[model samples]
Target: MHSVIETPMYLRAAKAAGMNDAEMKAVVDHLSMAPDDGALMEGTGGARKLRAAGRGKGKSGGYRIVTYYCGKDVPVFLLDIYSKGDKTNLTKAERSTLREILAEVANAWRESARRKAQELRRNDHD
Candidate 1:
């Protein structure tokens, strides 16, 4: 299973959507096991829209989670979440912004991993 990273924006959105700990955990667990579970969203830099059932609500009236999973190496990113009643789809501007943000996130993760590997090698040589 891949690791899941919940961004502050996502956390805030989840809370705003009234998703409790158990609900949040269920989403994370599902994403970890199947990072590519959702439908691919176009123009959003590989973002996917996943339907999550809310407490006492079915998937139809639940929440929509926006996730980014670049590859198996990079951890799955929970970018945002919103109630279905609040918003059904992202605007064109929003999609463009998400694309840019995802590009930055992927680059940052690659750089961090590279630096960590270099540090480990240096420590081993010392």
Candidate 2:
């Protein structure tokens, strides 16, 4: 199973957002540990429902949480931290960036499995 990972930047940002380290840790911790919440994860591959509030706006009136799900087996939904004042609600640029990031994460796991599959193939050939 994949392990949960967090960044120093996110730690500080979460704190600034009023979420303490413990709270942040708790969120990242249950990422895979907890059952599927409202949505599975649109980024993985499936239907989605963006937060009706449109994630609101930040100091510059352009920042908010973008919630979505990818697919069924995703296990957990992806939460994107960005701004809504950019273009449109859940616009292409936003989706593109989110897709790239999600793809990177998924690609890592796929790469590991691919290596294992190749090893099995070599063994069979031998």
Candidate 3:
């Protein structure tokens, strides 16, 4: 299973959307099994949106989870969440913000992996 990282924004949003621990766990579990299940959201710089069913609420009236998955090496990041009643789509400004955030997240993950690899190589030589 791919690891799942919940960003602060997502946590806050989930709480505001009234997602219980069980519901949250289910969402994480689903994403861990299928990290690429969500549809790619254009203009969000690789962000994908997954519809999560809430308690008694089918997907039609469920929550939207914004996520970013770099690859197998990197964990899937839950960027944001919102109830369907909150809003239908992201605003232009929100998309622009998400684009920048996604880029930075990808870059930082790559850099972290590179540093870890370098450290491992150095340790091997010792």
Candidate 4:
């Protein structure tokens, strides 16, 4: 079985964002076991997005998945869990939330990558 590494930082961020344990666990399971396809889990927001990239999940359980690239080969990091709005229009609040979530995830991914790199370097030097 493949092992997924969700550093404690991820859990902390999820908690900071008000994600209950169950919800965070669900996303982690889905992300870890997901096929290695480069499927795009596009963002919500609207038709005129400037820096937006994740969409909100609708009633069907499909939500926006923002991914942060770790390296040239590492699997993209799953950002956050977002619930969709009522219609085609994305409220200002929703967009702001989406950006905030993605930023947080990106920061985490970068940090993870740095740590992993440092470990590898230390191992190689030894």
Candidate 5:
């Protein structure tokens, strides 16, 4: 299973939307098991929109979660979230910001992997 990392923005949105620990856990567990569970959002540079069940509401009435998962080397990122009633789609600025964020995340993860591989090789030669 891939790791799920929740951003501060998502945490605050989840809290404001009345999502409790259990609900958040369920969302994370689902994403870890199936990181590609959602549909790819256009113009967000690989961001996805996942519809998760909230409290007593079903998926349709639940919450919308924005996430990014490049591959195994990178953890699934919970970028932002909101109740269905709060918003239906992200603004153009939000999409642009997400694209920039995704690029940075990918770059950082790649660097970390490179460093780890270097460490492993150094250890093997010891």
Candidate 6:
């Protein structure tokens, strides 16, 4: 299973959407098993739009989860969630903003990995 990282924004959105712990866990579990389960959202830098069942609602009346999964190595990032009733889709400007944010996330992750590798190499020489 792939690791999942729920961003603060997602957490807040989930809570605001009235999602309980079990519902949230269900989403995470499904994504962990199938990281690429959703439809690829264009112009969002590899973000996917996943449909998640709400407490008593079926997929049709559930929630939409936005996730970022670069590959098997990088942990799946839960970027945002919203009730389907709340919003149908993101605006063009919103998509552009999300693309920029995702770029930064990917770059930050790469930099962190680079720093860890450098530290490991230094320790190996000691």
Top candidate when judged by lDDT against the true structure: 1
- Candidate lDDT scores, in order, read 0.94, 0.45, 0.92, 0.46, 0.91, 0.91
Task: Compose the digit string of candidate 2's lDDT tens values, residues 1-126.
Answer: 324434454444444555445645545555545323334334433323322222234234533433333333333433544334443345556556766766655455557878989999999999
Tell me the spans in candidate 3 whose CA falls farther than 4 Å from its real position.
Answer: 120-126
What's the true lDDT of residue 21 in model 3? 97
- Report the C-alpha lDDT of model 1 over 42-65, residue by residue, as the tens digit: 999899999999777799999999
TM-score of each predicted structure versus truth: 0.96, 0.43, 0.91, 0.38, 0.89, 0.92
Q: For this target, which candidate reaches the highest TM-score against the unseen true structure? A: 1
| TM-score ranking of the models | 1, 6, 3, 5, 2, 4
* RMSD in order of candidates: 0.9, 7.4, 1.4, 8.1, 1.7, 1.4
Better of 1 and 2 by lDDT: 1
Where model 5 places Cα greater than 4 Å from the true spot, the runs are 117-126
Clashing pairs in 6: none
Residue 105 displacement (Å), model 1:
1.8
Error of 1 at 95 (Å): 0.5
Better of 2 and 4 by TM-score: 2
The digit string of per-residue lDDT tens for model 3 on 11-102 reads 99999999999999999999999998888888999899999898899998999999999789889999899999899888989999999888
Encode model 6's per-residue lDDT on 1-126: one tens digit a residue.
999999999999999999999999999999899998899898887889999988789988999999998887788999999999999788888889999988888778878988999999999999
Model 3 weakest lDDT span, ten residues long: 101-110
Query: TM-score for model 5?
Result: 0.89
In model 1, the number of clashes is 0
Q: Candidate 1, which segments miss by more than 4 Å at Cα?
A: none
List clash counts for every candidate, in order. Answer: 0, 11, 0, 6, 0, 0
- Sort by lDDT, top down from the best: 1, 3, 5, 6, 4, 2
- Over 4-122, each residue of candidate 5 has an lDDT whose tens digit, in order, gives 99989899988998999999999999999998879999998999999998878899999999999898878899988998988999999999988888878988988998999999999
Candidate 3 clashing pairs, residues 3+ apart or interchain:
none
